[model samples]
Target: MNTSRGYLVIGGLVLAEAALLFVPVAILGAAINWPESLDFAPSQALPLIDGQLGQVRLGYGIYLVYSLAWVLIGPAIAWLALGRDKQVGPLFVVAVGLICAWALARAIGIIRWLTASTFLAETYAAATPEMRQTIDLIQSSVNAWGGAIGEILGVSLFTVGWLVVVSLIILRNGGLPRILGWSGLFVAPILASPVIELFGMEASIFISTLSIHLWLFAAGFMMVGMALFGKEA
Candidate 1:
């Protein structure tokens, strides 16, 4: 494809990524209160999941697909960055690796919601008292581990690391506008800030997540503009 077409494809992919994110957010937020619901104890959460099993399946299943798309997006972003600066060979590999790792980790984390959590929720409703205790313990462990992998590692660490690396490349190469790079750099830290919550500290998780969406929207539009205007900065 020609340069313009190539950029248009990547830009479309980026915007689609932003749009995909909204689907699960809206579905889960409406269905079960989602991220907050994730904090509920098993006694509280399982019943809710069992009650709205259909929505849980739909929301988390879509989320899994969205996370997997990150693998494709990593290469698309790397291609754009390479167009600006071909010298970032090793870093390019690392960035793509991080994105793929994030994708896999995210899938691992979300799979439980669609599969194990559902099973446990269904069983929890009919289990004996002893079995209920067992289910509760299992649910707690599952959520803790899954949350760490998906939220801390995939969402915060790998995502921020990829953005920081790509933003630096953008800044150094002067391929696109420098402001786009700086905007990404600014949002990267905000994304990372939520990781501090693991240490029992208060963090603005909602704001941090909103920042990610904003950055994606801004970056998507900028790329689409570059495609239309055929600008190579």
Candidate 2:
């Protein structure tokens, strides 16, 4: 029932979720390589060129679970922080919105990857002349799916916008460090810009993407936990 303790519990849960989510990345990396001896061209393995179908499936599943956790618990933590303060109410709303946007984007990305990968892999195995043409059609469909995902990424810029706003709220309320708050504000535009340029541009901005999201998630967990359980400084 202690406030700081609640924050710590939330933080611990986020960290634990992150660790579990990260494992699938390693698993996918290790299991994803295809054997050259398989003699199937990349086109044949459309779903996953190497024995990566299983890995993709597993990774996407893990991502889904973690994404859901973030969407649900993230708002609960934010509510805990902001609900009592009338000034913080807007920030809580922003946090909830951003978390929802991120969750939706993540879900779309997972589905796109799974569907495209599976279709390609199945078509690759059937490589008859007729199947080849069908494969081409499927490939086009996959490309369209990619475009759709790009749109989702673009729309998801709201996540960064909300984070920046929430960071400011946290700083103003004196619950978290000013440095982190400033970083979140500064990082938002950089993280959000890639969504607009994603179609034609290389997504190198995802470096910032990783940085911002990780920081927000970690900081939210720690700050909330401490607020819930820790003694005042």
Candidate 3:
């Protein structure tokens, strides 16, 4: 397909992915009364975990969709990059590879939690002291090694790489607004989240969520503009 059609199609998919995430967040935000941090204590998670994981399951289901969409997004970005005739530099290749790999990691983390961790949480809520200890050991092991560490590295690397690569693309190619390119500079703190957490600043989670969503919103606006009006370019 021609560049314009390519842009239109990929752009729409990105927007749809963003909506898939956004809508669920909005609904879950209300259902759960919108916890400030995405991380919730076992107590906070207990209600939904007990009831067929009603709201929580719905939210996680959407997260699964979000995860699946990321698989598409990495390739979509590459399609846009190639359509714009940008150099597919080593950095570009590395960024895309990391994004794709981490996308899978993210999927695994979410899926594992949905399938196992929540069940463990339900068990923990009911188990006797001795049983609770076993559940804790198993749950903590899954969280520490299976979920937390993997997702931390995966999210940090892919997101940081994503922002840098997209910034470079927008700055170098005129396919997108340069202001948007400059905005990509905002990803620095997100990249530093691991270090930030080490410093006891858990606020990095909120910052990362806010900024990335804003970035996606801005990108969607620009891309949809291209789709509707600038498709001939």
Q: Best by TM-score, which number?
A: 1
> What is the per-residue lDDT of model 2 for residues 127-217, given as tens digits with 9 covering 90 to 100?
7878877776766666556534533463346567666766766676655555556777777766666565546654444365466657756
Q: Tens-digit lDDT track for model 3 on 145-187?
A: 5445434666666666777776776676656767766887776
The lowest-lDDT stretch of 10 consecutive residues in candidate 1 is 79-88
lDDT of 1: 0.85
Number of colliding residue pairs in each model: 1, 14, 0
Which residue pairs clash within candidate 1?
175-233
For all predicted structures, in order, the TM-scores are 0.94, 0.76, 0.82
Kindly report which residue pairs in candidate 3 clash with one another.
none
Q: What is the Å distance of residue 107 in model 3 from its true position?
A: 1.3
What lDDT score belongs to each candidate, Candidate 1 first?
0.85, 0.60, 0.65
Candidate 3 regions with alpha-carbon error over 4 angstroms: 30-40, 231-233
**Better candidate number, 1 or 2, judged by TM-score:** 1
Name the lDDT value of residue 176 in candidate 3: 70
> Candidate 3: TM-score?
0.82
